[model samples]
Target: MASLLCWCLEAVLVAVLAVVGGVSGQVEAATPRRELVPAMFVFGDSLIDNGNNNNLPSLAKANYYPYGIDFNGGPTGRFSNGYTIVDELAELLGLPLIPAYSEASGEDMLHGVNYASAAAGILDITGRNFVGRIPFGQQVENFKNTIDRITENLQSVDVAQALARCLIFVGMGSNDYLNNYLLPNYNTRNEYNGQQYANLLVQQYTTQLTRMYNIGARRFAIAGLGLMGCIPNILAQSPTDSCSDQVNQLVQPFNANVKAMIGNLNANLPGAKFVYIDITRMMKDILVRPAAYGGQITCLPFQTPCPNRDEYVYWDAFHPTSRVNVIMGRRAFNGDESIVYPMNIQQLANLDLQPNNG
Candidate 1:
């Protein structure tokens, strides 16, 4: 009886220890919920550009007047009359206004930075017709150089880690087709149709995105081609006030394929989230039904509602107005089943509990 009692006590003690250990392990395994901070880093072409290429000898630049006329009633180097998508995104996040990366006096480095060029594209050859367009490789190099400068300038900085937290916004590829292949000088349309062109562009983009991922970009907002066919520049080619079905046909597949590429990238890269914005469809919706958006049918005289710039389509010929860009950014942030989705930049930022009150 004594021996049996001793054995039973030992067994009870072991069981008690095991239970305590298990509970302790579970407690250690629990992770605290992370609060999302608003730190956007934009890099792309004119649609969301903030004048990174103003000084660069590229014809893709928009540092002149009339571009930012709507911004502060003066040129701010942004391609739009007012704020671009990145600027509005900063406001939505409640962060301070995003400054151009080129600004010598405004290099805060913490809030956000804009590195978009006017006519830059994924392919180096795309902007040949655009006078002085910078290539994707050159842009990437510049981005890296900027990061280095930031690290050297800031004290107690983990340059690699800071970049990981910064949201990378990249929009390219439009010029690759529009100015390079489709322009009168090149016109690859006669050889490779729209689908083929899109595939080529996507392949080039995949390489560039991979390079970015390798360079400490964990958070990304990768925008695809906008309504290139509907732009005033392309539409002017039609001359009859009709839409450019040729450009539209090419653009449709390009957006779809680009979205697919984003999905694939997300799957392949662990913990990488890439959101594709369908600005083409959104732009079309406004153009097809201007009254639905609460805007008039004509923006100016002599131009028909469609021509006059009713809420119908474009602002001038090349870009959307600042208001539309804000809407597009919001939609892109939100995601599918949203206004357009996989959540636009605005909606994604909302998921973060951190303050972005810019």
Candidate 2:
């Protein structure tokens, strides 16, 4: 699974994968009446930012219009039309939809807080185009504040044990590519080649992840970057009407490094269990046979979206449709080594992480 590098970059590559049946399956979340973990603390970009960016002055807002047409509240700042992958994951974990840090308070903070923001990234400069964003460091900083609040309420003595049993889920790095390096306005592309850039991202990410581990995040499900080139936003701009092999090529190293990071963390960190969710493979499945889940559409400004949005693989130019989100959630929750890697989330959740108490 190192690379789809040699494969030809054709729109019909989708058809090719479908015919070969390299990856195919529909995963549904198993309803669990019992909670898998005591809580979940999420961190990432728009892919799971429930509603953190609504009031931000940034242009990455998704609060209005046909955005959340299918969701319960209708446009709750989720990038998708319905449930986000995190929302589905929380449900599968038998927990309520984790609230955004900007909105959650009091008892809501006890379960978890979603610190994901629309334009956030591993690098601080990664999403400056949006003008205002809580970078990954800031998101972790926000979590620190939440931790302090929890410490005050329940006392710091009990907080460590609680956090040890909670799930720390993160799926980021897309915006670092989509919003920064690829943009003409940014200097990131000139500063480094793809591998160097990926290395830089992983380095900073390793620091933040280790910081979380030090703060009592013991169980982790870290999602790797997906098929950036195949998402409709990049596809529509491709010169060949196919996925941009260039963009996908740029992203491969990041996923590889992240998988390596998981192994390093598992070996070195005594009390933590880290699992890598191979979203690249799962997304390839979605794009390989998008028709299996839904159809495709061309976006037009101020236009009403397809009434039957459930049939489209993308909600808009940049994000996956809710059905695809559900598929990703299921894959992360219960998928095998091919997709989840090392170990899947279900096994990670059940893993006995004994406290390092003498």
Candidate 3:
């Protein structure tokens, strides 16, 4: 009887331990994973641009004081006070921040390179106001150059395969609207209506993204245009300091077409995992409830480092504050289907791609 009791106690203890261990295992499993992708290849405008515009003879350059005040490397040409969207995304990916294509050398190209330039857009003439910006086409060319350099360092096939696995981020189009269509000096508006212009932009965008696919990019996280009318720059344009509903309406078609484009790309491009990031919705959410998201609606235009930078959503009339950028990055990284359709960047990164013919 005593032996039987002792055996029963042992069994109960084992059961308890097993239960406890299972709970502990569940807790451990709940922790977030890291480094969903091998590397991140960024291509966009000022939103994700790090320092590509620094050396260029352009008014859009942001490599100066107050720009990188919050960054470890001061004044690294990020338009925001610190940590652009790409910076935060890289941190979430467990990779070091990607260097701008202009500055990246030798080992810098190993992980990836950022070809985004401040004021850059899909159209070559989009940022003509800036005078010397690298448009989306030239950025792609720079990326091709980077690929050649990578091929020289590593085996061409290995580089190609690695690129197939990397995350490709594109966040253009906003500049196309803000710097080209809306500019008083530009004739884009005279040439096309909102619908026609959006269609034209999508047509060009499709070609550019296809070129990226031809060059081996498979996983894509493309950010749609945000609510340009709500930015301080546009808001200031209003005599009553109100948001421009007209400007906001103008870009809706672009966002809609971009969603359609993603669906089409996924259907047509084998091995393509295109995730559409709804910047329009994301920005509106933050703007609508600025207090909840820890953001302010406005900031002084073109001023040196606002002391209360954290409170303002607009860092300087145009760009979002670093805090807002961090929040935006987090949402883009792991947001629900509502914000990031099909999947988020995290999902895109972890998705298994089929064997590519390339």
Candidate 4:
């Protein structure tokens, strides 16, 4: 009887151990995990600017009440009524909301930051004439300073490697030509012509990009000039609300020059990835079919009672609305195969994390 009792006791102990092991295994499976990707750093103008210009005294500030009125019913410094393209892209990537590189509150170094400033351009002197503003070169200097500050405080990971994985986004130069060159102030349209300006802009771009590359940035997403002539502001200047052919004619060579620059960058940097997101075709499609695109909104200058904004392209007179930004991001992330050589932003980042052997 004693021997039988011992056997039964051992069996009970084994049964308890089995139950505990099963519970631990189940818990392990239920836990969530996060995928790793390099940091995302943004640089440019109002196109990707997220309230960075808010704190700056620049006249280009767009973080006023009506700007973010659509987002949480209050101002968030975003030029749109809601989140900008940068915000949406961060959400898609599962990264924490990237703060405007200018914001003084809730700063985090590990995730990322935006150094974009409204009225900023590729050239150092691009927007200096504007009252109270930060130029592109200054913005880059500020970015470098910020990185130093973050490292000094955090002392977390390998800064250079972190930077290498960083996906640097640059969107500028349009305003340089528009507000500076094309406008009455410096209208070279009759003199230098469009092609000359295009060449100058490309040359300037090459210089700026090399600066970034030297700073350990390997991945780049450079968007080409959009259909500047089709913007509502430009159209408003016209008697019939028609797009300016002269302006578009200039844009063609500028975009081509930009494409050539990307090819050259790729050829020089074997591991580096450079891409161009064509905005002209996307803008053209929307302008051709305004009703189909959702650009219809009754805001006086925009024509009477606008239609659904989802289908349209232009958000305002100059910059794209959040809705339009989302559309562009989707196209950029998925439609690279149909465009010129280099892939889209999504593909470029993917390549950085998992480089191909062949």
Query: What are the lDDT figures for the candidates, one per model?
Result: 0.60, 0.79, 0.77, 0.62
TM-score of each: 0.76, 0.89, 0.87, 0.79
Predicted candidate 3, C-alpha RMSD = 14.5
Candidate 1 per-residue lDDT over residues 1-358, each given as its tens digit = 0000000000012222232234121111112223344467777777777767677776565555445545664666676656676766666566666676677343576666776676777777766665675577777776676666776776524656556666778878777776777777775767787788788888988887888777666677777676666565654456564557777777777787888888899788765667776667666554553323322222221222132111223344566665556556555655454344465665544433222211
Q: Name the 10 consecutive residues with the lowest summed lDDT in model 3.
A: 1-10
lDDT per residue, candidate 3, 1-358, as tens digits? 0000000000012222232234121111113347677788888888878888888888787776667777789878887767778888888887888988888899978778999988888999888877878999999888888888788878888887888889999998989998889888998899999999999999999999999998888999999988888876776568876779999999999999999999999999988889999988877676664333232232222344455555456666677777667767878888899989899988888787876543
Q: Which of the numbered candidates is closest to the native, going by highest TM-score?
A: 2
Model 2 agreement with the true structure over 1-358: per-residue lDDT tens digits:
0010111121222442343233233223447668888899999998898889889888777787567777889988888768888888889888999999999999998879999998889999878878777899999989889998889888676899889888999988999999888999998899999999999999999999999988878898999888888776676576766678889999999998998988999899888888998888887775666434333444432456555454456667677777668778877888878988778777887888765720
lDDT per residue as tens, model 4, 126-148: 66555555667776777677677
Question: Residue 250 in candidate 3 has what lDDT?
Answer: 98
> What is the TM-score ranking, best to worst?
2, 3, 4, 1
- Number of the top lDDT candidate: 2
> Candidate 2 — which pairs collide?
none
Taking every candidate in turn, the Cα RMSD to the unseen true structure, in Å, is 20.4, 5.7, 14.5, 17.9
| Candidate 1: Cα lDDT at 277 | 68
